[model samples]
Target: MIDEQDEFDEFSEAGEAEMDENKGLYEHVNITVDPKQEPLRIDKFLQNFRQNSSRNKISQTCRAGNVVVNGQIVKQNYRVKPGDQISLLLAHPPRLNVIVPQDIPVNIVYEDDDLVVVDKEPGMVVHPGFGNWDKTLVNALAFHFEKNGSKSDLDRVGLVHRIDKDTSGLLVIAKNEYALSFLAKQFFERKTRRLYWAFVWGNMKEDEGTITGHIGRHPKNRMQMHTYTDGSQGKHAVTHYKVLERFKYMTWVECKLETGRTHQIRAHFKHIGHTLFNDERYEGHTPLRGVNLPKYKQFIKNVFDILPRHALHAHTLGFIHPTTKQDLYFESSMPHDMADAVKKWRNYLEN
Candidate 1:
């Protein structure tokens, strides 16, 4: 059954009206630098005012003529004078609802007037696609907007980016058109921070390293992806990983994405011979059998029975708020099954 947080009735219909007026709009903040302040950079000063706004956004605004220092547009690093009259024009974000909303239950972590951060569970598809038509996150968001009488247009509602159906983690959902556009831009420009935790087979030789490759659809298997060398139709993907812990036959790793790509972490690990544990497609039973150790064999069998899905979870996400421009970060612990597997594996090693 779908669970929901208590309704926040503090907002009346009038409040919604007020929010509409402010949505996708920016307010100006003028600050006078103190001489003792040592002349902070323009971008830094603006960031102080817009707490959640990304540095890239501030830079973009300044470069686009939206920000004027002493009535003149300047580069992001321009030092602010003590009495500089900094004027900033905030633009409303474009509408983001391209798909129809369904009543999907999203585990909302944080919410405000402009956006929402949801902890999406595994097996929940973000958007509608082939083989799955309904009960998606978009559908649930549509129901939410409808219930509030904020029937957003199909082309512009709440979605910013998406996580794969089997990958669970924090996802940002925009509440209005302007916030949606702003957040989308941040993700597109790779200004947001996303960290994931996963259990993979084998110990990594290095503590941390970056994987760079061009990823594209598999030539033989249309449903799968492969690292492309010719770079004909693929985009550049980069994944950075740090070894967090190690087991006799497995390693717990933390991964950060410099560029978001389809199956990025999974594919990259597979490329490096450290495919995620219980990943059916990449690291199958052959690798497990290769160990030829009875205890290890029993552990693999037990793990497979209990953990049927990929051993990956989005552990942390951080980004600048689109409206208030404040820095925000959220984290989720590994699920019970993953934790259990780790514990059991470690105990086996100790014994």
Candidate 2:
């Protein structure tokens, strides 16, 4: 049996190896049906072909449109025919290792018997997943919980929601089962208030706008999410954005998510042709808007270098307390890199 770590390392290599299908980020798996083979479900065939794969996992891959037959995505139950050339994008492996407590510091905004509020910094992943097993927020929480003398298990320590690895922000972790259940309910019902600040390309005609689309993992690139406008595919998602500041070419905007789908803000803005600045995964690393003069291009490239990651910050989060039943709100100041980039743009505008 392949260990989880080995599987993740292979998946990581595959992701960094090549990119195709309009710059998608996923590994390509190709196979051909045997001439003497009988009809079988695509998912079943994949299960047999991919070692250590469960039928449920293969079904999920098919549903996500990662399984294609003869260059077309096939349904989970699609019957494979002889001579069919099968090609698909394989999804990355998940983290399956046991969570071990690490003595890492966490910026705790507030902590009570029921919960703890944390200010997560950039470049720190929220949980352990493939490629990242330690130095996570969860690992830090485990240490904190141990110090507090709580006997909660590793998996149920207190994680109700999560922000992206590169997106810095405020997050709440439940300390007990009751608190976790209560907080989870609020998030599921969209009762919690979350706000993010992002610098995106292009100028908006309106000061504020709402983006509604279906969001799902990109069929060709599992690394990113794709927005579906027709509502025919993916989960329903909504993001309302308001312009906070307008630069000569870029716009700083505030985003409020109505549905917390993965990459809702980034993918939704990209759908409207306003990808976030320095968001390399979605092609925001280059200048999408603005003049193409050598000086201007150089300036943009310099800004990208200064701000190494996407210009997105989860600045505000608010929710009612589960035990105390009191309303709570938390906010985080913008990171220094983003602040410095904004300052550079301001200087350029002055000159």
Candidate 3:
């Protein structure tokens, strides 16, 4: 049986609904309609083909051009014929293996009987999936529990939310099932507060504004998320931003999400033509809104060297404690690389 880990082609379709989804790697599955197969709508065919898939998901995949029949992109209603070849591409490869515990160090912010909060560093994936089975935060959590004389099966468990592998920030892990359920309910109901800080390109006309759009995986660009203004294509998302500081060409902003769809902040800001600084996936490295002088270009390159990844950080998270029922808030200082990059920009303004 073809599973989530099956390697797929670059005709990318859709990604995880969550923003913290990993890379653009997709799983391709080929389905050959039997010679005796009856003519059926492509959407219906795919639903029968993958029982685990939903009808709405197939419809979105078709719109994204992930469904190909005999080498042609077809709409959801296109009829499938006998002896036809169909190729499918989907994103966010599912969990392929169990998470293995490692002795990796984790900076725990708080820990108790029900949950633990950690200040996750950059480049550390939140959980296990294809290509990353160990050294994840969950792996470290497993060791944390074991070292404390407790062993728990954390495979796909205890996580209430996730941050991108390259986006450093804070995350809360449920140590017990009750905590997971309670915390998850808060997140799903939009009761938790999350604040992300980003240094992006372009100056804003307004000091603060709200960005409302639907977020989904890019149809053609496999590595980036896309924002849909029409709301017919993706999940509804809202991001509120306030300018924290403004440089000659770039702006540092704080974002709060009403709906945490995949790449909500990145995609929403990109929709307004203000991509994040150093966000390679979204063309932040390119000169989108600045002068093209050689000296200015070289300065941007120097900034990129100091901060190699996207300038985004999960700085604050607030939610009611699952056990104590008390309101709790946690904050993390910006990482050194991003802080250093900000400092360089500041000094450039002076010099």
Predicted model with the maximum TM-score: 3
CA lDDT of each candidate? 0.67, 0.74, 0.75
Question: TM per model?
Answer: 0.69, 0.71, 0.73
**Stretches > 4 Å off in candidate 3:** 1-96, 289-294
**Which order, best to worst by lDDT?**
3, 2, 1
Please say which candidate is ahead in lDDT: 1 or 2. Answer: 2
Alpha carbon lDDT at 97, candidate 2 = 63
Residue-by-residue lDDT tens digits, candidate 1, 42-111: 8888788677776666766665455667767777789887667666654333234356556667787887
Error of 2 at 90 (Å): 30
Model 2 lDDT tens row, 1-351: 111121111112221221111111123567878888799988888898886655655665576455668878789889999888887554332233677889987899898887888998778877775567678888888888888897655563356666777887798877655565456546655789889999998777789999999976678997778999988777788899999999868899999988767678889999999999988889998876547544888888888888899999989989998756789988889888899999999888787
User: Compared with the true structure, what per-residue lDDT tens digits does model 3 show for residues 1-351?
Assistant: 233343311212232122443233244678778888899999998899888866765776676566778899888899989888888765332333666669998999988887888999888877765556567888898888888975445753467677777788988877654565456546655688889999989878789999998777788985677888897776777899999999868899999988766677888888998998888778888765447544777788898988888889999989998768899999999999989988998888787
Pairs in steric clash, model 3 = 8-28
Q: How accurate locally is residue 31 in candidate 2, as Cα lDDT from 0 to 100?
A: 80
Ranked by TM-score from best down, the candidates are 3, 2, 1
